[model samples]
Target: MPRTAAPPRTADLQARPYKPGDKVVAVVDLPGVPEGTTGRIAVADGLTWRRYWVRFDNGEMLGHVDQHALVRARDWDAFRHARELERAEAERAAETSAEADTDAGGATAVAAGGATVNGVAVPAHLLARSKAARERLGA
Candidate 1:
């Protein structure tokens, strides 16, 4: 099989826009540093391959951390709020679409043999198995 080339890393000059003493929160887990760990930028290094040296509150001093792994502490709460609103809107839109489909002449109506998922027939046994799995997993 032929392998596809990885996406090129573009020069993101804005990556390490943080200055020394700027507060940031980890977006991903680092070695000995858990996600959401608040830290201060000790040093912002590199140009094309921007990285940071952070002094975390949990006593982890990590080096070469990229901007993708951190978010400005001031903006974290606003970012999370925006993301939650987007998700709730998406769920409401999906529910509205599903209801419209059901009301429009039984497009989503189930047949006698089994349940339908997105209008596709699912066997009764498979549906039962899925229900059992969900119950077992407490989902």
Candidate 2:
């Protein structure tokens, strides 16, 4: 049997993160507009059904344009920079969490001449007082 290609997954599709005032180029022709027309995103409003209103250079203003039909004019450079920043932030967060775990683990160890109570050191005198008080209260 001949093998068939799998349908594209949602993650395989590039996300359209369009915003107002973004310069874009249409990938498909629309009413009164041709492909490769330069435009500015006038407004972006939608929740589940995302769309954009674009004012093309050819004096055509199209509304309810599907985000997939347009691409940012500088998507390559802009997306690369954004991804690099996200990666750097993630690395910094991981390092910070690792440092915090190490610090907490070290803190739980009993220090010299002191007993730990809830991971914090209590002086010998304080421990003795607490023992006596506990005995008096029968607790």
lDDT per residue (tens digit) for residues 1-139 in model 1: 9999643222222244788999998877899999889999999998777689999999999999997777788766655565566678789999999777655424323544466665555667787898999999999
Q: Which TM-score value belongs to model 2?
A: 0.44
Judge candidate 2 at residue 77 and give its lDDT. 45
Clashing pairs in 1: none
Candidate number of the best TM-score: 1
Q: How close is candidate 1 to the true structure, as a TM-score?
A: 0.50
Error of 2 at 134 (Å): 99
The runs of at least 3 residues in candidate 2 whose Cα sits more than 4 Å from the true structure, single-residue gaps closed, are 1-14, 76-139
Cα lDDT computed for each candidate against the true fold: 0.76, 0.74
lDDT of 1: 0.76
Q: Work out the TM-score per prediction.
A: 0.50, 0.44
Model 2 C-alpha lDDT per residue in residues 83-133, reported as the tens digit of each score? 466678789999998777556644644454456554455666777798999
